[model samples]
Target: MLTLICQGSSFALHKMATGLRKGAKLNYKLMNEQGISLDTKDNSDNNDDQVAEDTRKDSVFSPVKSKAQKSNASSAEDDGKHSLPEEVDSDDQEIEKLQRELETLEKDEAKLKKIKQKEELRQKVVRKRDEVKALRDVRRVCIMGDSIIKHLPSIQGVSIFAFPGATIGKLSFLVDSRAVPLADFNFVIIHVGTNNIANGHSLQHMSSDFANLVASIRKFNKDIAIIVSSILPRPVDHSHTKSTVQQFNFHSQDYLASELNFKFIRSYRPFCFRGDIKRFLFAKRDGGLHLNSEGSNRLRFFFLRVISTLT
Candidate 1:
């Protein structure tokens, strides 16, 4: 009786164990059918949560991302490809583009430097030409006037042409006759109006004669620099002589101021005291008209100073 009872209990325990095993198998199959993974630690709800978190991270950083990074991220999301190698390629392309731009900038800088060098060379050429022209202008000078200009000592580049009793009209005629020789010189000094004043020629007549004389010179050589020396004051022979001489010099200076390439030099200042002519500067033999040795030396000194400025 005890053995039968034990066998019945064993059968009942085996049936219970079998039912539990089948139930466990059924549960596993049902869970798999519902898309729940037992091997991995995630269910459908966890997967959805992880996907939402990843999407949030991408959206939060989208604005700050480079276009290349954003494109790589988009492709990664579309095709499941990794973005690291593509990012490296983008960096290399950017580096190459920057290098090309730098090369272009360097080329532009070199071209600008060459342009500056060319401009500097051109300026040097222009300056050299001007210097040569100035040198040529001071090379040969001709002093033409009455006997007063003849007393000037010989200079290397100077030529003297003097007529003892030359009036303004007489000098003008001589210049017209010798225009060819006068044209060869770069400068002409005229010192002849003393005779015009002494000969009692009216100031209007003298002025007209002087203007015609300059016109004749210019007709021969327009490039020549003409210097006109004022008449020297003589001892007061007549009260009007000194006043007339003063008027002639003032008119000459005023007229020549407007004339191109003409300069008027006052020659009476050194030989005159307060208002009268210095008696020592004139030779008594010529009735205080011609300059003596001391007077000639002083005149030469000032004349040479004027010539120095031109050179």
Candidate 2:
């Protein structure tokens, strides 16, 4: 009876060991499915507590996920390393485009400013030209001569510079001494050379002296209009005969009009009748060498006509 009971107890103990071994394997498989790792400890005393804590953490974390999700996450990280963010790239492009546009606007603004300046300058120049034209339209006139012109009536808007027995050679001296303000007048009517002819000057000498006098006056004002009056005919008893005076007048008028660009007035023709001096045209006290009031009035009418055209 004693042997039989001992054998029964041994069989029960073996069955319990087998059941425990199977339970351990089932727990291990469950842990592996949850992605939990179990480290086998050499110390058997804390092994149960360590395994239970690991199992609780794995259940809470739910660590085991799909392989496709993990692969997608890794691919996204790799793409991020190689490429820029869409919003960031777009912002950079927009900034660059704005900068380029600003640069273009600046260039256009600069060009517009330059164009505006040029237009303003052109307008200023045009205004200046107009002012100059208006100023030249109304000219100041001066009549300069010898004793013959000195006896004439005073004219309006005409400055007279007369010296008796004054030759063409002395005219420049008067101008240099500032006795004649050449700058004050635009039109100059000169009646000299008659005295120069009377003083025994040759035609060539008188012409040269007259030209020099005109040139000196022009030097004072380049734009001055010079009108040279012809020497009038004198009586036979005078220093110069009518023929000699006519010859001098012709040569002087031709040279003044053609070469020197001066306007020559033919005042001598009106005072002469058929190559002879008109006694009525001469001053009664001057031996028919100087003009009378009648002659001066007639010459004044001619001078008025000449002056009217200039303005």
Candidate 3:
């Protein structure tokens, strides 16, 4: 019985030792698997931290980059609006200068045109002078006055120097200026003073101016026969009445004719019918101021008859 007990104890001790070894191996394997799992979890945590940091960085800088781009665009637009290229600016300045030059040229051209017209008028007056000088008749007659004398035909050996609005005051200047050549003419017929009356000059002033004009004609030649024609009546417009014209004629015949020894022609009688001026004797458009064809013929015949008697 003691031998059997000793064998059984040895077997039990052996089994126990084997069981402890197996438990140690199982614990060691579990520890190794847990260590590997812990390591993988740590690596995943690190990767997640890196990704979040990258996202934060992007969020912070994106608005700043976009603002910088907008600022650049606005600056470019401002440059386009406020400033032009150098070449284009220079061309605009040149165009403005050319427009100014063209305006100046137009003003100069207008002035030149007026000057040319004035020169042409002066040349025409000079040509009239030349024509008058070409006539060399010694027994020449000259009629000088306003438009009434201008209507006188260009008779042989006669010079009619008449201005439309000539007054008695202007007659002396007309004669002195060689407008009426008094040197070669033997007879001078004057029919002015109508314009003087129309211009509101007093009768006394008109008579005085007439006397001075007569004196100027006498100065040219003492032998020259000066005939002072009466002022014709205007039946129309009534600016000058028949009485006023008669008064001026009476003054010329009574005072100037005797004083200056000049002939006074009563030219108003032929146009009068029963102490009134005949309307038919004057032009229809003239308002009874100027003569018609019949009146002009009568005047021409009277002048010829008077001129024939002078020689």
Candidate 4:
């Protein structure tokens, strides 16, 4: 009874092994098509066990099973006859699709980065251009007067053009360029008619001269405000001077107003009325009829008030 049981158990083990071999062969064939390899394997013990099992299966169901397994393996090996496993083929197709999608995504990411960098550079250039333009459009302070403005300290943003021996007749020629330049000015501080007075020019002539200057300025800058400056204090030394400069300040102001509507910066308030003529108005070295540092301060405030009102 023990010998019979041993034979039956060996036959049963051989049958199980044959089925395993057939399944393993099918798996290996599928793996081969997918380029999967287990070539580095050492199956010496399994091969010995399979040989013993095959010998025992000869007395069992070996003949029938071997014939069936051979037919199945032959059919599986023939590419024209049998199809690849559905699960394996599906996995390969999914992997290929995912790989293509990943590549496309990578290319799109690179393209977006390039576009973003280019946009940033364009904005930087535009900002730089605006900064340069702003710097060039600086404020220009235009001075329209006699030699007084020319000799004053270099005020910020200030430019000067004063006719030394100019009267109303020469004014058009004297300020042909500066009239337009000053017309487009941030501030036009004018102090003329002094030369007209010193040279014994008539009040009527002075008025005409002032009117011409205003007319020329208005031609260029229509909105430019005109400041009709009254004659500054003439010292006692120039008392023997030709024209009635003091009378001109009082009467010519009304004359200038009638000719045109403009503001008048009267100097009689600070320098001539309350202060010394020679000490306060003219520099001792200047000798000519011109304003000193103290006198310039009065003119400065007049322009300042003009600026404040406009702003």
The digit string of per-residue lDDT tens for model 2 on 200-233 reads 7887888788778878888898889898888776
- Write candidate 1's Cα lDDT for 164-183 as tens digits: 89888888898789833777
Scored by lDDT, model 2 comes in at: 0.81
RMSD of 1: 15.4
TM-score for all predictions? 0.55, 0.55, 0.53, 0.58
Candidate 1 has its poorest 10 consecutive residues by lDDT at 57-66
lDDT of 4 at 7: 100
Which model, 2 or 4, shows the larger lDDT? 2
lDDT of each: 0.81, 0.81, 0.80, 0.68
Clashing pairs in 2: none
Where does candidate 3 stray beyond 4 Å?
1-138, 238-240
List ranges where model 4 is wrong by over 4 Å: 1-65, 79-140, 178-180, 240-243, 274-280, 286-288
Please tell me which predicted candidate would have the highest lDDT against the true structure: 1
Model 4 TM: 0.58
lDDT, candidate 4, 106-169, per-residue tens = 9999999999999999999999999977764545456666665555555556666666665655
lDDT of 3 by residue, 99-128 (tens): 999999999999999999999999999998
Cα-based lDDT at residue 293, candidate 3: 81
Better of 1 and 3 by TM-score: 1
